[model samples]
Target: MSQPEELLDESLRAITERTVELANPGSGRAVAALRRLTARRRTPALPVVVVGEVSRGKSTLVNALVGQRVLPADRTVTTSTWTLIKHGPSLAGQATVQCGDGTIETVPVNTVAALGTYLAVDGQQQLEDLHGAGARCVSMVLEVPSPLLESGLQLIDTPGVGGLRATHRQATLTALAEADAVVFVIRPGEPISASERLFLAEASEQIGTCVVVQTHRDQTLKAKAALDADLASLTDRQQWCALLGDQERADRVVAYFRDVKGISVSSRNALLAQDEPPGPVRDTLLRSSGLQMLTEVLQHDVVAARRRVRQRTELQLVELVLRQTRDRTRETVALLSGDAEAARILEDRRATIGRWVAHGGDLWRRRYRAGCARIPDELQVIVDRRCAELNTDVGRQLAAMKPTEIEKAMKGVLGLPAQVFTELLTEVDTKIAAAAAGVRELLERDGLAQQAHQTDDDGVTFERLGDGTFTRASTNLSVEDLKHATLGGMAGVGIASSGALVLAHAGILPGALAAAAAAGTAGGAAGTGLAATAATIAAPIFWPFVVGAVAFVAIHQVSRVRARTREQARTVLATVREEIAGTALTRALDAAKEVGRMVEEDIEAGIRELHDEADRARRDLADATTLTPAARLARISDAEDLLARVEDLRAEAAALAGRI
Candidate 1:
């Protein structure tokens, strides 16, 4: 194993065994989860989830990947549930359906076409009605015989009807959770809609590997070229351009996939070419269709990405447990030092917190809100200006590139918002930290903590955070319920530098695809990685950010750009700019809402923590006053031992985080 993996593997073992000694309930849960992950690590294959907007050819792409017509894919049919296809001794299918009252029904699917009957979301009401009132198939598992399946790779075909939107919201999240690699299918000229962007943003966090395929590449380009001669289709020489795809936003919504591996493959053509006798026509069709290259990506790029993802997941689990353990230790240390002198300090400190909240809480909240209110506009100007700059740079770069290189060229052009968003979050975190420092300086000026012991960092820490992190920032115990709650499952490890990821209990994080990209280029210390992770989880609005952000239509159609008049190219660039600005503006506004909520939550959290701490201190003080000398010494010694062990684990965690 490589060094990082070796380090992680060794840490996992240490945490699993040593954590059991901590005698903390939270550590017990972490140990359980770590052990579960350990068992799964022995089985290395990560399921690939194939996804797309309605009728974007997700099913077809899955079939292409399997190199067989195992799944039904007709224009009239739409997949409406999760279907897991794995290697089986024979071709067969089974489904799990649920009634409105939440009763589950099992159904046997005997044939390939029958699988379609259970899978279709439209044009098959009669077949669906057979299931009974309020009954809907929630999921299915199909056993398909294929060379691809033999390799232990699994593919999940997602439903198309509510695919990209919110109707099957939880179902979509389930897919995100299970996927180690994603195959995002789109047709020629389809700009990722806002909803698609939202889902991808979340999915990007769970897994860094994605393959974006533009289906109908050959046909769309040909038909589009004919349209340039005044709107024509296969059947009519004067058909409207709308026959090809949605063009109302064509001028404004340029097809852009950012930071993803995209290939334009004609899935239909690949299927047809398979049946043809060995010849140049067949060879050209398969090669030019981009099917061969896509298979390579699935076999190579995406498969390799899964390994890296596993490492990150292991890191997140270990880090969360370590932090929780640290907090427990810190609390223990404070309790041990609680005595006649400490009791007086705690009472006064708690009283001070009470007074501040009563007098200054509302004003602090307002100030934070005011700070957050200006973020949208600031982000808008930056995103707009960035896109505008990219338009010129992209046009210049594209002018000399071949069609095949367009995807490569555009990948570098813009994954807008990801970078801008990262920079913004870093700024926000820095400000929050600085504000905490400023509060400390003010306390020193007034000598409010004049009696606070210099040797006790806890007093300083709690006082500084009394109105900030010290109060509001506590372990969410989120990792115990991690899998379903949010992207925190994917994030907690890398960004614990500020303790924010562990503190915020963020159920949402910005897209990691872009963050990971930024981390690579901005490589410095673990602190930098923490800033990047905070940037992601802190801003969920950008969860609806960018895809591989390349114009795939231009990528596959080599001669099309050359044929376009300069006027047309300029128009395309103009639309690209508008698309970037409009999308960013809408998402920025959404982000502003999250920013406000988080800001308010942070302040409220502080207030809540203050009251809780005060109550705990009052109880601990009473206990301290009542303790016998011998008993007090025993508890103190025990607490000290726990605190030392915790500190050692924390140092180990810190070292590991630095490598991230």
Candidate 2:
């Protein structure tokens, strides 16, 4: 290899090695991701892609590389899909061509004419088959014996640009993704168009290394001069015109192969004629030296191919590993800090709560007797007034509602007064909740003060502190609180109901008559003896006490179950969180680390192998120096200039690395 190529190989080795180091597991995944991206960018194949406005000899160039004129070169657009061609060989001396998807097929030298049909390029309908197959199937491989070509180098032929129209632009763009380098072909007479410009803008950066091939060598000078004249006419952009070259009617076709490099080649037909018998055309074609020039271009790029592939692949892996690790870490942090778990835990606590309600008839009867004796007359006066007001309001409402109107209104109305009842219950619930809250606050304060007296199994002495000093351990209420409170509330309601019932009965009956009847009943009961009479009157209280006892028992049972459930919930939650933290999260993190390690190792190994291969290539290039005189001259003319360019590339690469 030349000194420039060696330097390039060295720089590539350094980059790959650095990438591997950065990709180490348990370290910076972001750095690894960057390495993978760099590796992808430095892929070995300097892809030579064929791009043009429709019908611009892209497929023809693909065929020429294989030394077989098999590509569809019809008047109509014969090539519809993006077709990739790679190097391959057959048992016969003739070239072998394999379609995409690794299906090998061979064509004899004589059978080259049949390729249009072989590729299904008869018409739009035939081309549709290839288009529908997608890029993978549409691609094919062709091998030719040319020392200038490198291993694993591919030349992609794209769909005719204008023929595909806007409808198929996406497919064209997708095909562009596979190209490592590009060859843009433009026909004579067409202006640099809007669509073409757009394609150039989008693809120029992606296909970083590009060459423009203006086909039909006979018209080369005319095309060049015309393009130059057009560009020069724009006084605003004269530099571009001068850079493109303004010479008219030259013998060679020109190509701006790089950012600041340009080359010219003679007609391909004349060069092919040289291998045939000597003729008048042979001398002229030989002087043009088109074959020799093209060969050098291909060879020069071939040397850099392997390095590019390694660089690109490593970069991709680095990026993937880094992104995955970062995402996993973020997810773990969220799981640990988020409120969702707390909400779930609270819901489980709610499931442990139990409810009970009861009112004893015995307690109600005692309260009923006392209330009746104390307030019978006062209750009678209030009831009479309330009844009078209700009757007047009902009469007025009835008068307002005519018989016909009443029937109509009654269709939608009910005696329940759903709206009013709902509001009334809501108000009652609010007041009860407020009262309960106040009671709880008072109880909590009292309980804190009484904590010194409360004793557990340890029997440790303690002193009550202020409310603020009480911790959650002591502030929690037990099932006993709910049971006692529920029972007390039921007893109060029973007493109030009993008082109302007694007062209502007094208003309905004459007080004097009732008293006389009660006295007579007592006399009768005395004749039967006080024991029998007492038993008869005690039945109501006896049944009330029995009901109260049953209610109390049920409440106790429910409270115990709720308390047990709460305890179980607390235990289960603790175990679940522990298992998740210890096992699931731990395993996930371990797996992530393992994946990172694998990627790091892969990148390291790849870098080492690439470095070794580059060294071997250097030795091989030195040992097998069999270039022709023309090849030697071509190399001398381009090598130093190319080295200078490659040096700049190294510097650029360094700058990019520094930024990273």
Candidate 3:
């Protein structure tokens, strides 16, 4: 069977070539989009990146999947670089390291022990031999003969987060995270911790789908108890996902992650089964390890996820081109037939989109700007109200707690800010939803965008957040660390230090807390795609929150505020609130305004695309109307045939996406 990408490529080339033959100037943008889409580099194999917090049995899980101890699975040895495993003809003993200077070096490995030693990421000294080729190692590839891998599964073992150095956390994770499916390995206890939640949130936003594996099933003799525990934790994740603006991601999280009970696997037990003789006992251990179910689920998700990514990324261009060509062809048919009334239908349709663009753009722009202007102040109100509540909530704990415990109480009591930011998120999501629906009403009503094309790819616009690069918004930090940690850290684009992540790929969960705690600096939002069409934007919210959290802790611990009385703590917090509100929150407000402007720009750009389509139809119809009656009839014949071809291509694009 042809992959969706192959089919899309074939269809796109046909449609684009035919469109070029017609010499349609209006199809230029759509044609160019396809050219750029097809010209980009393609992945040879589907990358299934295995990621998790440190010591969560990620390496062990990879070992069990491949039925070998090729990687160092000892928790003590931190696997720093990525171990990119692909299918090989034989169980070859060799290691290839891609250096930072764009050079690749291969070394012969004598034994499994030698592979482990050469690839170990424990200490700088341990990797000296491996690092001798270059100043930095990009990734290490190990080829192993496995039936599962032979099926085009490229398993990558990355260093776990949480325990990684601050210098390397978010940047490395973001780069390594561009995978078809993320095998998120977790230990038995924490279905997820705080840092792990942040990482998973980022993963869900970036990749859209992942297969979560609960490792170390052998450690617990769980009959139904373990399943229940895992289910409860995942239930919370479902609720959180429901809150995001990308309803598709939320729906997928439910569909993909709904049955995780069977996905629990024990790598140790699976490895032990491999050591056992081929007998009933060994088979029982293998079944008990749950490795079969894990692999099955992983494979199912792998096949399904690649298609989704393809649809969202490149295949979208094919669909868009088909829509543009189809719409234009329809108008051409009517224009050539010389049926003034039939052609009027398209003219009126173009006029509708035109009216929406002219009238709706200003209306939505005003509303969008108003909402954007209101949000910062609303966020400030959320801050002030939540802080007042925090002052009250922490006071009760303060009466019973000692001065030393005040720091702990302050940090814990500030849960109010999280709630406040969550409210802000809800408001932002509402406005974004409203913005998307505002223009879509006309598109859906008239069937101009064909209603089918209204999905995220062609006609849809404005997910709640966009992934834009951010500038520093906070001022109270060292230049080196705070630079990357601002809005993306707050909730803009980049992966922040692993505190809290809220990504539509624009994160506010971490940054909102930073704004609340340290009186946030400016945060940013952008569309990384064409008008940020492909993905949502929200900067990270990690580092600023970390800085703010620490700053809040410091502010709360002043000697006068450390007094036994609850009132003194309240007084100090009151002072801190004023300071944060006047300085940081105002900056946060400015950042939010910037986000609002970007949201308007993206939404308005999408609206303009529709208008441009109508405008092209108008021009084509005008040109055709001027032709002689004999010439017009001849043009009608060509136009009808062109329409038929576009319809076939459109159906193919639809069929490919329907399964995806």
Candidate 4:
């Protein structure tokens, strides 16, 4: 490293260490960003994306540049996903598949051609079927042992957009958006398409540099000239205005694209000449291929541009850390003097936040209550519909069933209420999540209210709680318990059997009330006796009139029993809705209250910290007053040393900024 690089490294290390020592709550994100910046400084790479229409020689150019046939090239739209090529100790390849649920899977591959298996439509379909809907092939990674990749140059080969689907165009555009620089390859015989021209115009706005390459120079020189003329016309402001349909932007874009440098290269000749000894024939082949000029342009333009971007990013991060440190130092200095004005401002701010805490709690409660008020009615509608549907279906079945079959069919309908309760529970969960989100939004808004005070003031602000904290309270109920409760409640109503007496004894419901409700809903003892008699009426032993009377009585009693059961089930559901809604609202309010308490506690902690700082300042003042002359001189010397260190860091930052 040179003097400037060494100086920058030292300054960044100091900033990172100082941030760690300060350990301010708000500094966590800043510290993490600084660490990443420091790591990037250690191993910086310039990302260059190779893009073009199908069969435009993008992959061929990349293979020639790397001096290895690592990327597969063909006449068709061969590349299907973005492939990042980098330097490794040895050749390696991997494919990264992103599933619909935001999970990533890495599949190792043995050859570059094998990558197509993952990127192809058939492969994607298989993956989708395996991973379920919305799964896709995201991107691929390839590592090669190449000299160009070793010197901090990363080349990305992208899918061709020409003659392909609109999705391919979108994927290419997305790649271009993140590229540091772009290489647009064109064939000699074809003029730039409308899509390519539009893409170039958009790339001009997003990327720092773009270089055009005219491939297949082995073709007629006249064809190359024609392509060059076409490109020159495309860059003209008037043509761009016609192509892009924006006057002011056309002017800007034309200026950017006008001076874009283009080089002609035959990748075929370049690849063949790589193994030949130096001679006139070799020189001629390399010159005609234009590989030498391309290398020089990449080194001078693309590499330098990347360096500038990296330096600027590093400078920004350093300045952020410096500003934070200075702010903290200023606060300490104020505390050292035990400033009465500072104490009064802090107290006033604390009082303001306390008022917000109280008011916000009440506001959140009102909003939560109002949001939950509609849930019961919504649940009632669902329950009523489900119940009516069950009744109609059961009534039709009863009309057709013989006497012996009636009891068996009616048992199935008894379990229908469990399904309704389950659906209602799902709806309740959805509402609770919504209510929790509302409460969270309210808390966040109040949290940001302190930002205005922070601009002209210096004190700790409340950190907003995480999402899990707000949602946990409302989601405490277990689905299994709900399922069991619904089933148990249905079984107690005697729709299936005389087992209702057993459920009553087991105290699933209050004993006498359970017995009475079950018996009444089951059409009383008379109804049960009629059903028993009807079961035997089908036997040959029963007389004809007796069988007829039993059948009539059994049908009538079954109807009466079903009607009573329907009304009782509706009443039970209504009660369940009230209980569940009440529980959800109570949990929501408790969560809101917890948030308010946290805010109040955070403010109180800030007040205590300020008081402690003031106390330390008082002690320091006393010590200074009691210091001997020799001790005072020593203190002055220490202060001078710190001042010199500060000046040195400031000059280093300025020099780094100039480099950026």
**Candidates in order: C-alpha RMSD to true structure:** 18.5, 41.4, 14.6, 25.4
lDDT of 4 by residue, 36-88 (tens): 33444545666677988877888889989988776767633242466777788
- Displacement of the residue 43 alpha carbon in candidate 3, Å: 6.4
Q: In model 2, where do residues sit more than 4 Å from their true spots? A: 1-46, 91-114, 118-120, 123-137, 145-152, 162-164, 167-169, 220-223, 227-276, 286-291, 301-660
lDDT of 3 at 486: 18
Clashes of each: 12, 24, 36, 0
Candidate 3, 470: how far from true, in Å? 44
TM-score of each: 0.46, 0.36, 0.47, 0.41
Give the candidate order by descending TM-score: 3, 1, 4, 2
Better of 1 and 4 by lDDT: 4
lDDT of 3 by residue, 16-72 (tens): 455445434444433433343333225446667787776778888888888888887
Model 1: per-residue lDDT, tens digit, 1-660?
Answer: 788678776775675457556736534434433443444466755667787776778888788777778777774434345678887788877765543344445677868777766665432343435654334554577888777667667787875422222223334444554455677766655554534644554454344466666787776655333322211111131221232121321211222123455677778888878788999989987886678888777767656555555554444456556555665556555665563445555666667556647655653455555555566666666776777677667777666766556655444433343355444433443343333334334333323322121234462223223232222112323211121111111122212222222111111122332232223221112335543443343223112211111112232233234324445455555544554565434544554464345434443443455456567657765785578878777887887777677667667755764554
Q: Which ten-residue region of model 1 has the weakest summed lDDT?
A: 480-489
Task: Name the runs in model 1 displaced over 4 angstroms.
Answer: 1-36, 42-46, 51-57, 72-80, 99-103, 127-129, 159-169, 175-268, 275-277, 301-316, 320-471, 474-660
Candidate 4 stretches greater than 4 Å from native: 1-43, 98-104, 113-137, 162-164, 275-284, 309-660
Candidate 4 colliding pairs:
none
> In angstroms, how far off is 76's CA in candidate 2?
1.4
Question: Alpha carbon lDDT of residue 457, candidate 1?
Answer: 47
Alpha carbon lDDT at 161, candidate 1 = 20
Residue-pair clashes, model 1:
12
